[model samples]
Target: MSPHPALSEEERARIDYLVPMDHPFDFRPAPEVPRYPETVRRNALSNHPLLRREAARHHQLPPDLVARLAADDDLGVRGLLAQNHPDTPAPHLLRSFLEYTGPERSHLTSRPNFPTEGAGRLRRPRGP
Candidate 1:
């Protein structure tokens, strides 16, 4: 039986559309998924981390939602915003890089605006 039995067929379809089947670390959303700004914003504000994560992966995610998700309590939501959303601020990307040890860690470094010069300050000194 499905874990989320209450999910309607449309809800299940939305999940299937957003969640990639392969290249889990890829920044790009599924090309075939239709843009739905209202739905994306709704998901971004969802209390459930999984729903927030899905919203974070959307290519057309609204700027307001991006800002909101950047401050999300769930590391997964923040990390997905940093990884997938082009408009994610550098601060959020840096925070995600520092906090998330996910497979996409390296990719965050390559983002156009990801800060590099002062990154050494973020690391702790080795044992004396």
Candidate 2:
């Protein structure tokens, strides 16, 4: 049996409001959300619609949630934290690109995660 009830068309449309076309919503709540006694957390944050979106916003994020996301097992979740974290190491940010292959990595790379002093080099050349 599926863990979550089937999402209605309305819910699916609502999700569309949050993410653009071509973004996949084939995700479900991770078992950890319910605290299954025997299972260790895996991709818990990544599967959550709320968590990933909130991480993307990078605004008014609480430290506890950020820490949880940073330590999340899923590379996507960790990548989001790295992108949003105010102090992600440059080495770590670059490494995430190699380790996690997906739109999430692309999104993070577009942000300001490079080495503090090296970020300028990564930016596009100013228009003439």
Candidate 3:
């Protein structure tokens, strides 16, 4: 039903845009994202999803960021970081997982790829 008797096709199109569409999904690819250099891109450590995902994909991210993500509040994000980060300290990460509590601990520990350096260290037990 048209809202106005005198509405033209263009006006009707404008009104359609104002009204929410029944289908909320956007199938179109995002337009023109700018490219950043590796140095500038390191700032993506902030918690935005797109930035974080982009940072996770960035090959030049530092080892420190990878190590820091072990304590990230978001387990899934942490897991992604763990999986993607290069040169992660295997023993340190496992120790951090042992220290983690609640759901984060459970999620991190459950990963099959979680570094086993700590386990290897424990098995060797020191002489008195």
Worst 10 residues of 2 by lDDT: 35-44
Per residue, candidate 3 scores C-alpha lDDT tens digits across 58-97 of: 4345666665554555443444454444444555446545
TM-scores for every candidate against the unseen true structure: 0.71, 0.38, 0.38
Q: In model 1, where do residues sit more than 4 Å from their true spots?
A: 1-26, 120-128
Model 2 vs. true fold: TM: 0.38
Predictions: Cα RMSD each? 6.0, 10.6, 14.7
Predicted structure with the largest TM-score when compared to the true one: 1
Top model number, lDDT = 1
Query: What TM-score, to 2 decimals, does candidate 3 have?
Result: 0.38
Q: Where does candidate 2 stray beyond 4 Å?
A: 1-58, 83-92, 116-128
lDDT of 2 by residue, 1-128 (tens): 11122543344444533323344312232333333321212223345444354453353345566556655555555565565556555566676656665555555565465655655565569998
Instruction: Judge candidate 3 against the unseen true structure and give its global Cα lDDT, from 0 to 1.
Output: 0.44
lDDT of candidate 1 at residue 105, scale 0 to 100: 83
